[model samples]
Target: MRIESPPPSGIPGIGLRPIERSDRQAWFDYLRLPEVHEHTSWNVHQPEDLDPLFEIHESVSPTSPRRLAIVDLESGRLAGTIGFHTVSDLNRAAEIAYDLAPPYWGRRLATQLCRRVTDWSFETYGFVRVQATVLVGNERSARVLQNSGFAHEGLLRAFRMVRGRPGDFNVYSRLATDPAL
Candidate 1:
């Protein structure tokens, strides 16, 4: 594949740039929504607790391609964030986690954001697979993956220990070979 450059509009809906560090509070506000956070990689939110984790995004090595913040074009708000932290070069794969602010839910923002980043990853970095795990009850998160072309691969009983309890999980994956991709 030639991996053409991303659109001049810079990947459309998630196009708003530079992911202002000042938006950290807004990002924290998103986490406070139970609808948004129940399925999140981080399950709880408090004003003081978010800064350190938000810092992790900010601290990504400048040369490292593992992190990003995506903004909403219409509102210039931090729609959400997406990143790859557990990466395997040999397998050409990475695990991604992202979410749109609670108010942005159901607007197809998450799907657009996922596609924008995945396209960038595949075209820019040659990833063969992108994967995510959603808690079984989180219909919203599951829909985001499905709408973005990921398929449910498997289910694991008590697959993840989240918020201190064993919970069922659905593993969703989208391969570079996927027709929709």
Candidate 2:
């Protein structure tokens, strides 16, 4: 499938670009952060564990989850990543996930990134709904979704396994008809 590059989001001082091969080390380093895995399902026990993900990132398709590297425009630093996954053309829906380095946390960057990607997905994919699942204790991410106009759907019991333990997650969603934040 031919995947068209999304136009640069007009947000100032931040940009989203494709994750490149050269980013493998940086991406690995970010994922290695203990805080990054605290609320996420990612289980990166070792460096080699990320090989499969890197492979997937290398050959992304429209039907597959589109991963975009979030960069600091002025410094050109890899600040984080955001992506839409579980896309269903028939259902016109998808799920979103994101992570930022600890240095970028508490800055409302996640909210801006979520808003940009949500708009892009709805506009480019004609998705009627975009969903995001946040670990139950992750108030920050939940707030980011809500701030981005996503409504709380419900709790998903044992939704994911984080660090080998079953975890509950809160499901939030935004519809194309929802007012933009």
Candidate 3:
């Protein structure tokens, strides 16, 4: 019952693919940026903090069958990454998450990528729902979900122990029956 990784989104100008070792530097560089993690899940990430992720990317295509490295095909660079995590096939649901290189922000790429991925999941896995949560102050992420057609759900007080401290979260989601982009 392995889920195949979703095909490239066919965004006309960009493609997202499973990450590769060659992408290590690009991803590392982006995560290393001080502003990338601001008001998000992590307080800060050292290059060493991502060692396991790089290892997994190099050695495995995880059961999740995800790890999309955003590519600006025109420039052929791995601008960032997005993936579905904590997926539960039996429940026909999954949590969607993503991040882009800071330089790639504000271009609507995040919204586009999220939409493409959600469409693929609903179509391929018959997923009844795709959900996302954001740190309350992460307006950008919330906007991505909204722009991609998700409905705002509610807030979770002290929702997660992010970077070792309790932090509030705002939930949002889109169902298979929701509007299409």
Best by lDDT: 2
What lDDT score belongs to each candidate, Candidate 1 first? 0.70, 0.82, 0.78
lDDT of candidate 1 over 1-181, digit per residue (tens): 1112332224555553434457678877887787776775565556677655556555544323354556767777787776665677778888777767776677776777777777767777788999988888888888888988898999978987887888888998888888865
Sort by TM-score, best first: what order? 2, 3, 1
Model 1 clash number: 0
Positional deviation of residue 174's Cα in model 3 after best superposition, in angstroms:
0.6
Candidate 3 lDDT tens digits, 28-143: 77776767766567543555666566555443333353567788899999888887776676888888888888878988989988988899888877889889989988889999
Stretches > 4 Å off in candidate 1: 1-20, 58-65
* Predicted structure 1: lDDT: 0.70
* Per-candidate TM-score against the hidden true structure: 0.79, 0.90, 0.86
RMSD of each: 4.3, 1.9, 2.8
Candidate ranking under lDDT, highest first, comes to: 2, 3, 1
Candidate 2 lDDT score at position 97: 91
Segments of candidate 2 deviating more than 4 angstroms: 1-3, 58-61
